[model samples]
Target: MKPQLAHSRDPEMKSSLQELLIYMIFLTDLGILTFGMVSTDMFYLNKVMSSLFLDTSMSETGNTNFKSIESVDDFWKYAEGPFLDGLYWDASDIRSSIAVNGTTRHIYYENLLLGVTQVRQLKVRNNTCSVYPAFRAFMKECYGPYHYLSEDKEHFGLKNGPEWWYFTSQSLSPWHQGLVGLYSSGGFTFTLPKSKNASIDKLTYLKEKGWLTRGTRVVFIDFSMYNANVNLFCVVRLVLEFPATGGVLPSWQIYSVKLLRYTTYYDYFLAFCEVIFCLFIFSYIIQESIKMKILKEEYIKNAWNWLEILLLLLSLLAIVFNIYHTVEVSSLLEYLLSNSFTYPDFYLLALWQTRCNNMISVNFCFTCIKIFKYVRFNKTMTQLSSTLSRCAKDIIGFAVMFIIIFFAYAQLGYVAFGSQTDEFSTFQNSIFTQFRIMLGDFNFASIEQANGILGPIYFITFVFFMFFVFLNMFLAIINDTYSKVKAEFSVMPSREFEISNRIREGYRKALAKRKLKRKSTSQNAILYAVRQDRRDKE
Candidate 1:
């Protein structure tokens, strides 16, 4: 793209140099501030939340004992103790409007929550599987609990692949049919009214449904509660993975508490940062639009054009997401506040906010990367670009060969060890296992135990071919390309290298209207009167 300037004040400086200088100065500041906003919002939220739930604070609340809620009894311990105490504080802002004889009910939890009293005394409350619509929808679709893309995923609570929808729904067997906490994607979703009890009622129900028994191997439980204190819903996930065949009751359990917060002060600042980045986006759009008008079909040939397009697309989405997050959070928080006594359902909003955060992160990354486009004047960056461009075809071919060979090995590994080895159980797992093997994270013993004869042969050959051969082949391709690029750059200056030199020449030209305008080596005229008479005579 040609950088054009109208009515040049300085005769020395090129238009491109001025553009790069301005672009770098303005865009880098904007990107840094935007990234900081994202980070700060998360940091503040986490800090406050940690104080409420972690370490010493939780110990004070008597919740430390039941922190790892891997079983039904552990959760009951938490609910009966700190959870009830927390509700008293959480409901402080939303105390009941209902009155007894022209006076507000002084019974806090009973008045604030739908039910917490029996015989004019506070009774322990119950917990239930989440009734959040989006959560149920996602579960109905048979999607698992966690979001991270991983190879070693275990859908301990939800149903599994190919047959997830069927086995989860229509063809569901007795044991897992109404498996209590998490059954189908529909799950054990019950109205969290007075009926939904937090005690071992669900476990008993699970036992009745054949999901839990004396000989059961594992069970996973997930539930949520509303906190009006922060206007956020916290979800608690549990895993009861201890051995049950030892004639002892399952004694080991694990739990994690996760929550997404409402918008913070920095969220508004983030919106401001979005607008700042918008200016840069607008500038690029104008540049690209002008180039497209002039170049027409030829504009499609430039890869930078595509990067600009992608950057603009992400920027637009980020702006929309920011707006969505703010508006949705405000409205949802209001709704949740009014209904603070009931279970809060903010799953979709949380998902969207998380998705928005992820987008802004990607947008900021692209914003930083966009700086490279303006700074191609640097020799090393130029060489790196050249090397990639030169080896693009070779790398593409190499990637194809690598995937084919890699997939072949993955399939073989799955066939040999998938049934017994957890890492090799799924196709995605097999691929990740191969990658991990190269990284020295694989368990050779597990592989051998899975299939004694094929295990050692598979491990050795996979390492020999992948680690020693194809992987090195890829590196060699890059090394050779970079060497050629280095030699070429050594012989001839890049087109942009002239801009760097021109920037040096335009140092004084770029002074603009600053106090030190156009630096001069001119001498000052020192005036003297009577004192100069002796000097003049001399």
Candidate 2:
């Protein structure tokens, strides 16, 4: 009997080992699949995606002046102070040229289009123009003349053209693009027209004021040059090359590239693993459905089943979109390579990629949530579900009533204090502000400033009804439900465990009955053989 028992236990141990091996293999496969996906994404971002967003050309050039007058106009509209006050230059100077040895004073403007702080060197002829003599003198006094003056013509585009007068300006630090920076080294030349007389009186007036001297010309510099329209175009081009925001929409073109790249090696392996796992899940669901004998509609009525169906549908969509996007990108690349100068329209590609990303993000979230289904078999989870189920209707009713009162308070606050406080400036803001107040972010000073008398009354009443009364009631309902659910769960086994226990008991009984029948049959056979022998003897 001991040997028989040990033999029986050997099969069970083997079965357990087999199950463990399968689990380990599955986990390894899952890890590989995840690693492959993530590695591909990182590679794409580093190698390809990042290039799409960065303006490599601009970076190489160091200073690419904004060409549009609209940008300048926009800059002037928003700029203030004496430095920005008279900073506008005649647009006609763009095409005009400065004389060989002549000096003229003019203002040159540069817009830092990308909102980044830049150090720029402006080169000018030795006798050309002096940039804001008073400002320059102040900078020279503080930081020294060498720090504010550089004679490097080749560095500031002097070699490009003889007519070009270089002007160098250091923009405010990148974090503070709104503020103007102090005067820095370098200068630009502006040529007075041959026919027009030099304004000596104006020069003398400026000279007496120490703005200019016999040799130095004066030029005013400003660096507030962001234009919305120009920026939109830049953003689109940038997003195509890198992973930055293109206006309001997110850029996911690089992510798509990574997904496509990884598919070459891991696609089949991942697919095999996914299919095996999904088949098991599908069969289990089918078995459950058959046992329940429920209609299709009834089967989907379960939240968990609905989630499974949704996950399946989303996965299918993701695969289809991925394949389509890959083909499109490949075709576009081929065409671009052949044409050289031609560019493909990436707007549709970006749009499709955005949609795909949204789908992927939603699928990832649902996958995370689906883990709860397996955990739902646990006793604590079962009790939690029961408590939530029992209290759902009451919670919904309370929420509806609470919302009505909350909205009323929000509207009242908006109407009463909208003019006085920014938080309560509108109906929408008032609602958010009221929520903030509940979270203890309320400012009594702002409320008191709005209306001293009504402010305290509103605060007191809102806190009493919303926080003290309704909030306590809400907590009490949940606590009571939890207590009841816990007591019930302690007394009775979970539904899943109860069903499994019954099945195991029935299987054991069936095995016992079969053994008894087999033993009885053996005894009958022995008796029959003895009877036959006695008959032979007779």
Candidate 3:
């Protein structure tokens, strides 16, 4: 009774263990799927952000403590004052008027342009009040100010002399043809006012006219410039900061500015769903890893197992890097909001995130490859496995011979044709080109260009040997092995079950052979003893 109970309990334990293992495997699969979904979502979000940000035309407005000066009255307020005494001021005779209610007095200041230029030039000058300090900082941090200036000069060649080159060649577009001619041809300058009295009067008058407003007023300035080859129309915004008090000196600032691109609600929702999915995948990977009973060294020996581990590791790394990037971006944005003197440099974060996303995408591909292991359980896949396995040794031996000759040809082609043809640029490229030719992507013209007559001979001979002869040999080996494996598998009930049964039958036959040998030895011994007894009787 006790033995029966023990046997029953043992079976129950085995069944429970099997059930647990199944549950774990199921959970692991679920987790992997979830992570896959998460990775896809992240990729989608990245694409959306890239597209939105790349489209520089998309803009959003925000209230800033910057001033806007739309008319001559606003400019005169700062220009006539003692504020100009310390700073250089140049005005242009190119007066333009925009009909707001009536024609508002708009005078383009060349001195203002000079002032902006000088401030930019004086990199170490601390006293120079810049309206777009954040912009300057952002540019300086992301791309050095000098480098940015140099690039601008190089992009738009310095034809109109160094001092006025940037301003003159800045707008390259047919749309701003008249405006560019107006600004370049005529402009005015005024030295900083020696006293504050004159500037105060102008400010007071402008204040009375309701031009002096609190915070910043952003004005979009459009212009066009043409280089010899291309015309570019550009827009720049002016940030004007006017203080509440009339006597205080006002701020004038100009720098390149960009607005942060906004993301849609759908993007956020998708990201949220992805996060949940990724969590599940992460959990499953961890559990699967722990359930592995093999030693680390032994576990890594299996290619599929190693791949699984690698996928898990890369996913984790990607997730960690992404989290860090998100945090850094959020922190940077917060810093920008708190201190307007600083701006967000999303380049570093964007680049880092892009790299992580790319790695995750690769992991997803590998995961798909890993799924083939399960597919191999099918009867058709089993036959494929057997065929491939049987052909593997022969293929490996052939590959060794093939690689030597292939590389020899590759090197020869590279040395002979590298200078003349783009295809044979390097040994690696030569090898790839040969492979392409084998696949019927042969470019006779390009090959002929390398050595003319010799090129065609070399290409024809190489193709004849490698593609027609060697490749056919490779295919023949595979085809022959595949046929044999398929025929053998066809005779079997099931590949796996048949193999196990054959092994068992072989074991039983070995035991039967041993038993028969023992029986024969015993019978021979008895006959010998009986003959000895007869001799003794005689």
Top of the candidates by TM-score? 1
Instruction: Estimate the TM-score of every prediction.
Output: 0.61, 0.44, 0.46
Residue-level error in angstroms, candidate 2, position 127: 53
For each candidate, what is the lDDT? 0.52, 0.49, 0.47
Cα lDDT tens digits, model 3, 256-352, are 1111212446445546655765775677587666758646567666776777678778877866765675577567658745743221333334435
Clashes of 1: 6
Better of 1 and 2 by TM-score: 1
Better of 2 and 3 by lDDT: 2
Best by lDDT: 1
Model 3, C-alpha of 346: deviation from truth (Å): 3.9
TM-score winner, 1 or 3? 1
Ranking by lDDT: 1, 2, 3
Model 1 lDDT per residue over 1-538, tens place: 2234322423333555677778776666566655553434334444433343332224554444433555545544544444334433333355554343211122233322322211000011111124577576555322222211211122222343221111122321122122112222222222222322432364344334433323233333333444444434433222343232122122221111113322567645645665677787788789889999999999999877887788788778866765665676566557756754333334344445556656766766776787777666567888899899889999999899889999999999888788899899888899999999999998899999988899999999999999999889989999999999888777873344445566665665665534344233121213344447768888
- Least lDDT summed over 10 consecutive residues: which range in candidate 1? 119-128
The sequence of per-residue lDDT tens digits that candidate 2 reaches over residues 317-349 is 766776787797577557745643322343345
